[model samples]
Structures are given as structure tokens and as C-alpha cells.
Target: MSEPLSVSERDGHCSLVLTRPARGNSLSADLVEAMHEALDSAERSGVRLLSIEGDGRNFCTGFDLAGLEATADGELLARFVRIEELLARIWAAPFTTLAVAQGRTFGAGADLFAACSVRLALPDASFSFPGAAFGLVLGTRRLARRIGEDAALSVVTSGAVIDAERAARLGLATGIVQPDELDAVKQRARRDALRLDTHTIAALRQAAGDNPIELDRDLAALVRSAARPGLVQRIIAYRAKAQDKNRTDRAAAPSTFQEGAVR
Candidate 1:
């Protein structure tokens, strides 16, 4: 099998691409670890900008559903914690981070996109977070920081797909452009990112504020929720609901990817 993720750097810009297109670029443990390594390498290399995108139809459909189903409760909670760590790392990265979202960006995928300093999406791109359905609070603080508490609450609780325009309007996306304009947007981002020295960028981000307390609070809430009795049953029910929605959607029109919760 091919690698689930790939990283390449040029002209002080690093690109991290998700490679599991056939699986809707669903994130696996190995894939997440690859991403962490890529971030480490980019930082070590003094990359001025980091760009994330997926290889094919969907940016990412979220965490691997099969992995979720097979993992024991203890292991699953650890996985969720790891995901939160990854998102936090991305959110706190010193230099500029850009996410090029396209197709179905859902759950933790949306969390990752929201974590980026700059997020661009294709006209057809759509984002949703299904974690609320399972009572997961992993990215609540970071997401609210991006789009405000009201919008964040609405999106997460409703599990409604926010299309490109709505995403930009809500500040979930910096901008939306056509597929043909993607390279130009990336170039602009790289140029602007490179114009600032690393120290200055770090200082600016520091001034923007750090939410360690909020993050800790949200994480504690997640642990509490996951530790509750019948938590596993709740996840099962959430997945069933998503599967039912997927079936209905597919009946109306063909879907290129499988649908499920993040777990």
C-alpha cells in the first residue's frame, strides 16, 4: 500500500498532502503520526509556510471509522486525545499554516482546517463536525476561537455541512476560490508568509492570545464525557445515525466517500 501521507518542501514552503484518496483520506493513527513528523521536520527546516491538502476527491472524511469500531475504549480515548494534541500543535505552530480544503472535510478534518492560520477552500468544498453527536469535545475551544462561540456551537451541534461561501462568512475559511486558482492562492500565501521574519510571526501569534486554560477545560470535558457509563453505546448510536444519513444522501445522489463519525 502507498504511504497515507506525504510531505515536500520547496522555496521555504512545505506542503503536507493526505494520500488515502480511495478511503476519503480518512485519518489513521499512522497517518496522524506521519503528519506530526512532517510538522517536526518543517519546523526544523525553518519552513516559512506550511500548506496542507489532500490528494484526491475529499480533503479528509475524518478519523478512520473501521479503526474506531475495532479499538477498545481505553485505546479509543487515547486516540482522541492524540488527535487533540495534533490539532493543538497545528494551532500553535510558529510560522503560518495554510489548509487547502476541498470536497468533504468533516469532523477532525474540519478541526484541522480550523486550526490553520490561513484556510482556503475550493468553491465546492464543504465542512462539518460530527463529534458533537458523539459528545466529543476535542476541538471545541479552538473552533470557537476561529468562528465565535455561537457559530461554532451551531455547526457542531447541527452537523450541518457548511459550504465554501458559508465557511468564509463564518471565518472557518479565509477565502474560497475555484480549483484553477488554488496554485495562485498558495503562491500568495507563501509570499506573504515569507515576508515576515519567524520571530515577528511568533510574536504576533503570541499577542493574538493563547488559550491553554480553555483547551484544558475542553479536554477535561471530553475525558469526562468519554468516561461516562454507556459512552461506547453513545458512539455506536452516533455512527448508526451517520450511516443512516449517508444512505439517504446516497439514495438522492451518488457519494464518492463513506460517511461516519470521528469516534
Candidate 2:
């Protein structure tokens, strides 16, 4: 059976799992729609705690770069805006949102975790926010909340992998556990989370209301900035850099040419 985003529930806990393992659970258009729909249903269903995870070893590898290329740039930009909307919806969600991250989490994937109330990382998992690579501007408030301003800027700009221990220490991840023990840790968290009343959950989130909105504005602005000619050129430059990673010899290809890999 084709795996749509998977959802399951028990007690007051509701869980969402990104499925498309063949593509490393990447957030494609379909997955994005599924996420929005899932949020809608979860809210209507009286879920007290919402848990998000990925089906494969990785939490999420990031946007479906291959899919991103096939679609129009305008459409991609619209989706980035929609993500801002989603972040707001997530913050407004009645339930306490929990991100259960394992393996790779980058770009959009990292943003998803940052949107959550609790971020649980597998000890082997890692994250990155390489806006420099794509000429896209990923903001840092979500990241800055976890790490400081300088480290947040460095990681997002440098596009380097931040490992689990460091992520936890930086506050990017609220808790870190060995991969094998992650399921157990998640279970305890979920169980305790379910006991919390909806009012309590709402109150805790209400106290942080402006935080998500500020981050959303920053993310949305960064995305629009990429639409500018200069940033778009940088985006194109990054594409070549990406291609260089795959090539062996120094013989260069056309900078403007699209590769066998479209995304």
C-alpha cells in the first residue's frame, strides 16, 4: 500500500509519522498537504498531545529537492509561505506538540522540529539548516532559542551537521537518547503528556504566543528574499556547488545547465 502520512492515537495522545521512506521521508507537496490535513483532524479529535515522527531511520531529510525542481519556483515560494501558516497553526494547536527526531533533520525538517514544544533526538541523529547552499533564508529564532545567536547563524549559514549531543546541549533537542531507547523515552513522554489537561497545554503555549509568529515572519521574509535576482543567482551558484559534489574530475560543466539531478 502507498504510505500516506501515517496517524495513530491512544488515550489523549495523537501521533503523526512522515512515511515516504523511499525518499527519506522528505517533505514533498503531497506530504505538506498531508501535514495540514493531519493538523486539522487532530484538532477536531481532541488530542491533548500531538507527537510527530518519521517512519524510516531518519526524522526527515528535508524538502524533496527532486520534486522542488519539477515544480515552479513560484509554487515553491508559496509553499514556504504556507509553512509559515503551518507553523502558526502548529503553535495554536491545542495539544502539546512533540518532535521525535532520529537520523538526519535538515532545512524544512529541522523547522518542523523547531515548531514543536518538545524535541526528542536520537543520539545518532543530526541536523543542518544550509540556507547558504540554496540561497534560501532560514531564520534563526527557533534555532536561536535552542542555540545562541552566533551558533545559530553559523550553523544555518555554514550548513554543517550539528550532532545530537551538541544539539541537546544547545537546547535544540530537549532530550537525547540512544536510538534503541528512543521508543521507550518517547513512550514515557507521551504517557505523561497525555495526563496534562488541554487547558494546561494551552496555557503553556499561550505564554509563548509571539515566539512562533516572529519566527514565521522571519522565515517568510527569508524565503521572499531568495526570490530577488541576486539571491536567485546565489541559489543557482549553490546548485553548481551541489553538482560539483557528485563529479570526480575537475573538468567543469556549464554553470547554468541543469544536471541529471533536477532538484
Candidate 3:
């Protein structure tokens, strides 16, 4: 198989693109590992900006459901831990980080977008956080920091879907543009990012005081939740309900169930 992820350097930005189009760019164990390595490489290369995007129809649909079902608990825990660590790294990156989301961005994918310094989306992009339905605590604190506590709570609890417009209004997305304009927007952002020296960027982040001390606690809670006697069974049941709802919604009209693959 070809690489599931790829990274390249441009004028002033390191671009990371998820390459698992056929799989809806889901975050599989290997893909997550590749993402972690890419982020590390971006930081070490001193890139002024790091841009992340998906190469397929959707930005991402969350964690890989098939992998989740197949892996043993020990291996699954390791993957989840690495995923949380990757999110934390992105959240704390000294330089600018941008997530250019298109199509669907859900679940851990939404968490990844939430962790970025700036989130830009195409006009048709949609986002949702569905982990709560599965009792997962991933990225809760960081998301609240990004979009405020009240909105974050509503989002996670309700599994509400938001388009690019509402996403920008709610502070979840920084900006929205037409799909064809994505490259130009990225170039503009790249220029703006390159203008800031590394020290200045670090100083800005420091002054913002966005350091998150509670994320570790949240991760611990997620571990506990996952280890509950019937949590996996609950997850399977929840997925069944979601799938039924999706089918009903699709039959009613077009399905708006873009809330990632917590399924």
C-alpha cells in the first residue's frame, strides 16, 4: 500500500495532507503515527506555518471504525493515546497552525481542527463533535477554549452539525471561502505567517496564555471511560442507532449526519 499521509514544504509553510481518500481519510493507527511524525518534522524544520488538509472528498470522518473494531484493547489504547498526544502537540505548536477543512470534518478530525491556531473551511465544509455519544473525552478542554464553554458543551452533547458559516460565527472556523479560492487563501495565510518571526510567534502564544493543563486529566477520564465494563458494547449500540438515524434522515431528505466516525 502507498503512504496514507504525505508532507511537503512550500515557501513558508509545511503542508500535511491526509491521503486515505478511499477510507474517508479516517485516522487509522498508522495514519496517526504518520501525522505525529509530520508534525514533529514541521516543528523541527522551523516552518512559519503548518497547513493541514485532506486530499479526498472529505477532510476526515474521524477514527477508523474498522480498525477500532479489530484491534485488541491494549493496541487500541496505544492508538488513542498517540492521537491525543498529536492533538496536544498541534494545540501547543509555537508557530501558526492552520486546518483547511473541506467536505466533512468530524470526531477526532474536528478535534484536530479545533487544536489548530486557525481553521479555514470551504463554503460547503461541515463540522461536528460526536464523541460524547460514545463517552469519549478527547479534546473537550481545547475545544471549549476555542469556541467558549457554552457552545462547546452544546456541540458535544447534541452532536449538532454546523456549516462553514455557523462555524465562523461560532468561532470554530476562522474564515470561509469558495473551494476554488482555497489555494489563494492559503498563499495569503502563508505570507502573513512568514512575516512573524519565530520569537514573535512564541511570544504571542505565551501572551495569549492558552496553555492547557486540563487536557491530561481529560485524557485520563477518557481512558477510564473506555475501560468501563460495557463501554465497547455501548459504542457498538450507539453506532447502530446512529446508522439507523442516518438512514432515516437520508430517506427523509439528504442526510446531514457528518458527525465523524465515532461509529
Candidate 4:
């Protein structure tokens, strides 16, 4: 199998690309492990800027649900806990963290984007936090810190798709940039990241907000949600409902097309 992540460093900037385009760059167990390893390396290297991007089509479609049928509830809960840990690391990173997202950034993928210090979305990108649909509480605090309590509550509860424009307006995304402008955005981010020493950056981040206690609380919340009985069943049911909705939409599309043709 191909590698799940690509990591490269230049100057003071480290770029981590999610390379599993075939799987929508979903966070499988292997991908999550690779991310932790990459982050560890970046931290040791004292990289000033850490940029994350997806290889194709989508930034990430969220957690990998390919083997949901075979996986046990305990395993699923462990996966979510690890994902929450990854998000926490990004949220409190000493170096500046940037996420350039495109296409469908949903669930934990959207949480990953929110964890970054700078979030840039492509014009076609859309975000939805559907973890609530399955009773998962990942990234709630971090997202609220990014936007606001009410806004985060509304989005998570409703599972509404937030377009790039709305994401920027709500402050979930720093900006919307075309593919051509991405390089410039990264360059600017690099400059900002290198402006301060790692120690100062870490200190500033601490002073600005976020603490170990809150991080622990976030992890605890996720664990509590994931530990609920029937997690596997909950996810299975959610996926089934989503699939049914997709089928219904697709079935309606043909009739709408025929109507337009008749007109």
C-alpha cells in the first residue's frame, strides 16, 4: 500500500500532505499514526510553520468507515480518542499551523482544519461537523474557540454544510483563496511563522489562550461520548441514513432533469 502522509521541510517550514486521495484522505488508523509521527518530527526540528494539505478532490471526508462492519465498538472509540489527541496537538502547537482545505471537509476532517491556527479554504470547499449525528464530541471546544459558542453549537447540532464564503464570514476559515493563490498564502504564513522564535511563539500562544486543563477537558468529553454503549451501532445507523438520503436525492435528480427538459 502507498504511504498515507507526505512530509517535507524547507527553510523553517514543514509541509505535511495527506496523500490518501483514493480514500478521500480519510483518517484511518495508519493515517492517524503517520500524522503523530510527522508532528513529532516537526516539533523536534523546531519547524516554524507547519502546513497541511490534501492531495486530491477533498481535504478529508472524515474518519475512515470502510470496515465499520468488522470493527468493534472499543476499537472505534480508540480511533476517535486518537483523532482528538491529534487535534489537540495541532491546536496547541508552538509553531504556526496552517490547513489549506478543499472540497468536502467533514467530521473529524473539519475538526482538523479548525484546530489549525490558519485555515484557508478553496472556493469549492464545504464543511460540516456531523460527529454530533453519531454522538461523538470531538473538537467541540476548539471549534467554539475558533468561531463562538452559539455558532459552533448551531453548526454541530444542525450538521449544516457551511460553504467557503460562510466559513470565512463565521471566522472558521481565515480566507478563501483560489488554487493559484495558495502559494502566496503559504508564503505569507511562512513569513509570519518565522517572525518569532519557537519559545516566544509558544509563550504567545499560551498567553493568548488555551491551557492544559481545557485540553484535558476536551479529551475527556470526547472519551465520554465515544465510550457510550452502541457507538458502533450509532455510526452504522448514521451511515445508513446518509446513504438513504443520497439515494433519495439521486432518484429525484432524474425527474428534475426530465422536467427541465420538458420545459
TM per candidate: 0.91, 0.83, 0.91, 0.96
Residue 96's C-alpha lDDT in candidate 4?
Answer: 95
Sorting all predicted structures by lDDT, with the top scorer first, yields: 4, 1, 3, 2
Encode model 3's per-residue lDDT on 166-242: one tens digit a residue. 99999999998888888898888888898888778877876776456555676686677666555556567778998
Ranking by TM-score: 4, 1, 3, 2
Q: Would you give me the overall lDDT of model 2?
A: 0.74
Displacement of residue 185 (Cα, Å) in model 3 is 1.3
Q: Count clashing residue pairs per candidate.
A: 0, 0, 0, 0
lDDT of 3: 0.82
Higher-TM-score candidate of 1 and 2: 1
RMSD of each: 2.4, 5.1, 2.4, 4.4
Worst 10 residues of 2 by lDDT: 254-263
* Preferred candidate (lDDT higher): 1 or 2: 1
lDDT of 4 at 41: 93
What lDDT is obtained when candidate 4 is compared to the true structure? Answer: 0.90
Give me the displacement of residue 251 in model 4, in angstroms.
1.5
Candidate 4 lDDT by residue in tens digits, 222-245: 999999999989988998888777
Clashing pairs in 1: none
After superposition, candidate 4 runs with Cα above 4 Å error: 254-263
Q: Write the per-residue lDDT of candidate 1 for residues 11-65, one digit (tens) a residue.
A: 9999999999887888788889999899889888989999999988888888776
Which candidate wins on lDDT? 4
Provide the lDDT at 161 for model 2.
75
Best candidate according to TM-score: 4
Model-by-model lDDT, in order? 0.83, 0.74, 0.82, 0.90
